[model samples]
Target: MDQIDLDLLATLEADARLSFAELAERHGLSKTPVWKRVKAMEEAGAIRGYAAQLDAAALGFGIEAFVQVTLQSDAAERFEAVVMAHPAVRRCHATTGAGDYLLHVLCRDIAMMDRLLRREIARMPGVVRTETIVSTRTVKDRHSLASAAKALGKG
Candidate 1:
């Protein structure tokens, strides 16, 4: 992709709600070109589908926690299946560290978090142990895609 394509991605990342005409106006291009660029990016898998960013607190998920899981055996696939099936598990990553997998979980309250740990995670087939750290605050939750694009000289 060229500089114009990078600029288009950066603009869309800032606000996906911009119309083709608005994007054209901002980028000094015609609507057709703007639309074509966005479409091409989508087809090439560079531009993913968009969605609204929601507040977990407003949605009754007041507790956010990270869990470090150690497995009893090399049953990562089995454990991964269980983690993926649970809605409360927002993110999970396989890592090369003190733990086998790292999980980000959301819950309504402390009681809900406790239940999730005891009834679900602890009893999972391959789970040997888990350490959970509750998040007291979120400092930086936004993406740095624009800066990354700029660093690549695409902006």
Candidate 2:
């Protein structure tokens, strides 16, 4: 995408709830073009559906932990099955570093986290070891496309 498209995406990423007119005004464009560009971006899969970022603590999930999991086996099918079954795993990534998978989990409390680890996650086939680190503080947490773009040297 060109600079204008990138700029438009940046503004929208910051606040997807903004009106079309507002976006157009921010980008110094007419409403029609802004609407068309946004539509095109959406169709292209660059602009995914917007979502509200809620606080886990306020939602009854008082504990946040990053669990590093090591698997005895590296079979993709088995790993996919285990990861897909657990809804508490907010995000899971197959890594290239020391651990095979890193899972971001949200739980109601320490007890809940321990329960999930011992029962669900630890019991999964091929799991060799698990390391859990509870989040004491979140310095930065925002799912914005503009931040990604800037990181990639597009902004």
Candidate 3:
């Protein structure tokens, strides 16, 4: 991708709802070329898909928790599959640390969080133990990767 593509990515990252006309105006280009560039990006898998960023608290999930899960040696695949299918789990990562995996979960209340920790997650396939940290507040969340790409000299 060139500078125009990088700028387009950054622009789209800020607001995916922008129309091709708006994007073209921002980039000082015409609608058709901007649309073609976006289409190319999509076809190249640079742009996978887009969705609304929902408010978890507004959706009734007030409690956000990070769970560090340790599993039996051979249960990685089964544990991942179950975690992937679990509704409460928003994201999971396999990391090198004290725990085998990190899970981001949401619940309506502390009571629900407790149940999730003690019953649901603890009972999942091959869960040996889990340690949870309930977040008091989120300071920052997800952001665009455009800056990172530029930093990596890919832009």
Candidate 4:
């Protein structure tokens, strides 16, 4: 993407609540082009819908963890179904490292996490083993393309 597009994404990352007029003015561009750029980004799947960041602890999801799961088989469809059924599994990714799936989970507490793991997670068909890494602190949490760009040495 061009510099202008990157700048627009950066501004939006900082504040998605900015009005179209405000964004246009800040970028020194007319409203029409700014609108088009934003629309194109959305159409191209670059801009997912904006969301309000919430505090997990305040929301009663006090426990956060990375749960690495190993399964008996690497069958994609079966794994997809199992992963999709668990709402507490925030982010599930198939990886080539130590485990088959890496899941980001949030729960009310350790007890709740344990209960879920026993009743919901461990019961899944073909699940072999699970290892959890509890997050002591969240140093940084961002859901923005701007952060990703900066990590990639593009921003």
Candidate 5:
């Protein structure tokens, strides 16, 4: 992607609701080219689907925790499948560290989190152990695609 593409992405990252005309105006281009660029980016998988960012607390899910999971080497796929099927698991990453997987989970309260840990995660197949860190507050949670582009020298 070129600098114009990066700028378009950055503009969209700031406000995905902007109209094609507005985007074109911001980039000093016409509507058709801007629309085509966005379409091409979408087709290329560079531009993912847009959605509103919701507050977990407002949605009645106030508790958040990072769960570090260690699984048996042989049961990785099985454990991952279980994790993927659970709605509470917002994000899961396989890592090269003390833990095999890192899970970002959300729940109604501490009690709910406890039940999830005891009833689901702890009892999952191949789960050797787990460590959970509850989040007291979220200081920053920006999805910085623009920053990423700048870091990669694309912006």
Candidate 6:
């Protein structure tokens, strides 16, 4: 992608609701070209999809916790499949540490979180053990991939 494409992506990353005409005006281009560029990015899988950012806390999701999970030797696939299908799990990462997977989970309260841990999570595919760390406050939730790409000279 060129500088123009990178700029468009950065703008969209900040606010995906912006119209093509607005993006064009911001980038000093016409609507057609801007729309075409965005469409091209979408087709090429650079721009995956657009979504509305929701306030989890306002939506009654009060507790945010991170779990470091260690599974049995041959249960990675099943464990990951279950994690992917689970709704309360916001994000899951396969890591390189002693723990095999790291899970970010959201719940309505501490009791719900505890219940989820002891019931659902414990009964998942091959959960050997898990360590939970609850967040007091979210200092930072998600970062911009477009900005990171530009900073790393990958855009």
Q: After aligning candidate 5 to the native by TM-score, how far in Å is the CA of 94 from where it should be?
A: 0.6
Candidate 2 off by > 4 Å: 147-152
TM-score per model over all chains: 0.92, 0.90, 0.94, 0.90, 0.95, 0.95
Give candidate 1 misplaced runs (Cα > 4 Å): none
**Candidate 3 on 90-131: residue-level lDDT in tens?**
999998889999999999999999889998999998899899
lDDT of 1 by residue, 11-128 (tens): 8888889999999999999999999989999999988798888899999999999999999777888899888899999999998888999999999999999999999989877999
CA lDDT for candidate 3: 0.92
Which is better, 3 or 4, measured by TM-score? 3
> 1-87, model 2: which lDDT tens digit per residue?
667778888887788899999999988899999999889989999888888878888899988999999888655569768788888
**What global local distance difference test value does model 5 have?**
0.93
| Tens-place lDDT digits, model 4, residues 1-155 | 66688889999989899998999999999999999999999999889889987888888999999988888875557767978987888889888887888889999988999997888777776678888899999987866677567667774
Clashing pairs in 6: none
Ranking by lDDT: 6, 5, 3, 1, 2, 4
- RMSD of candidate 2 to true structure, Å: 1.8
Candidate 6, which segments miss by more than 4 Å at Cα? none
Task: Answer with 2 or 6, whichever has the higher TM-score.
Answer: 6
Clashes of each: 0, 0, 0, 0, 0, 0
TM-score of structure candidate 4: 0.90
Q: Per-residue CA lDDT of candidate 6, range 50-71, in tens?
A: 9999998999999999999999
